[model samples]
Target: MIPPVSAPDFLVKAGWPGAAIVPLAGDASFRRYFRVLDGGRRAVLMDAPPPHEDPRPFIAIAEHLVADGFAAPRILARDLDEGLVLIEDFGDDRLKEHVDAQPDNEMTVYSRAIDLLVDLHKLPAADLPPYDRAVYRREVGLVTEWYCPAIGLAVDEDAYNCAWDSVLPIVEQSASPIVTVLRDYHAENIMLIDQPEAYGLGLLDFQDALAGHPAYDLVSLLQDARRDVPPEIEAAMLARYKALASPPADFDAAYAVLGAQRNAKIIGIFTRLWKRDGKPRYLAYLPRMWGLLERDLAHPALAPVAEWFATNIPADKRHQALQEFALA
Candidate 1:
């Protein structure tokens, strides 16, 4: 990521000149977040300093989420020119932290999350960029671009894409009315709210939401790159979601295809984080991600991708790659 250009003086410029600001955790993007305080009021200050980051997409998506009766932070103020926005503060009870503290409640927690998705899927996807085949192909191409070289495998971009080309259409043909895909909808980005009427979940990091296949966010949630979701919990939640929502004609196959695509893309992304950005912590997720990919590959619809992995990356090589990159 490029260095942040300058601190936005927007809050000071707009009345609360002495608002207390404290740094919060950031993700892979160029955007930074800060907790802001003024008198008794609290809000989140998003520092999305541009030429590298944009705030419009975030504001648009947050509006959509709120309009749909979901728990997205309320935008209090904005200065798009400076890439700054002050949003409501949904205080600390991230789903991941809650799950960590009470593992037994995992099923209940996931079910509630699934309920939110079921409601969201009923509505029309917002006017946003489509997560179409071209996008899927480009993203999945990450595995070939970064991962293969990291593990000392030969590069053959055309052949790799050819393999995915055969499989990706399965997703395109099966998807129905698209829904808002909060592309990063997972445990880390979901905050558990305490208020009874507040939807029980707070959405975050959704600037990249797109009109995408419904199964895409499901895959993101179940096949989380950052955590080891229990096999039983994943299976149960998937079943629960399918039972509640009227899914597409080829829902199972579409889910598998998107899961495989997401996992493959993540492998390359984690490798890039290590090699290009000096972030090795992401490398530790590689082994788990590999395991998830292998499971997704077992789906019959993923035959071509599975075959590609089998021929180019044998089990021994796969294990070797994991051992080489994963944390001890």
Candidate 2:
């Protein structure tokens, strides 16, 4: 919760004075942000819910990304005491909105955007924490537990075992050292705005960036929340990434595993979001996204686990649950 600390008081505390403050937009998180207007300069103020939201990691990663030449907004002042940050405003324009209005230019923008991943993944992540086996397994468990309950598909023991068994091995075999996995590296998080470099992707909503595989972020981008990314574009991005990063020949297999894991978690998340958060609009995206998960499973890489999803989880039931919304 942002205290009643006046914008003037914040400016005074930060040693910058006389700035007109305006509220910025925020999403479904404990954090609230405001875009401050000071003279001709602008900055963003972040108010994170204390106790539940920690500013330390957000500040730490912000510093690292800025130092690495990624266009993360500069952190001007972070009041750890109040869970507030007076940071540079990266503008409000996101890539999803940009390309949605101008579909003809998607490939051009995305090709440049995909290149940014190369910059992020090439760095050493020794300083970052791990998105290790424990977290990975727990994330998958959410799908079976939360998402399945919405449609009443309690995955049997064998079915549950099948998913983890196939996915766990691929994750373990990835052997790729951990890097800053921007957990939700989608178009909405990226600002497609004016910059000296054409690829100056303005990043927002990155507080959840973790230490994990490069493949994880890639999956996040290609399997985006707001749009159905074309298959050719996805493959092209992967090919471009592989050419530069020199990931193993089986990186695609790892990507398939990560994609399945991520999409499953999202299916559960959309279900939970609607049922728990009172945000039912997300439910509209399930049909296309479910089909996406189904298509991903067709890959031989995901064959072992696909049967569990198909056998234990019937599509007819998924469609039936979906019907609950249409009639509403």
Query: What does the lDDT come to for candidate 2?
Result: 0.76
Clashes of 2: 2
- Go through the candidates in order and give each one's C-alpha lDDT: 0.85, 0.76
Give the best candidate by TM-score: 1
Off by over 4 Å in 1: 1-8, 319-328
Give one digit per residue, the lDDT tens place, for model 2 in 270-301: 77777777777777777766777787788888
> How does each model score on TM-score?
0.93, 0.90
Model 1 worst lDDT run, 10 consecutive residues = 1-10
**Candidate 1 displacement at residue 4 in angstroms:** 7.1
lDDT, model 2, position 198: 31
In model 2, the Cα lDDT at residue 142 comes to: 66
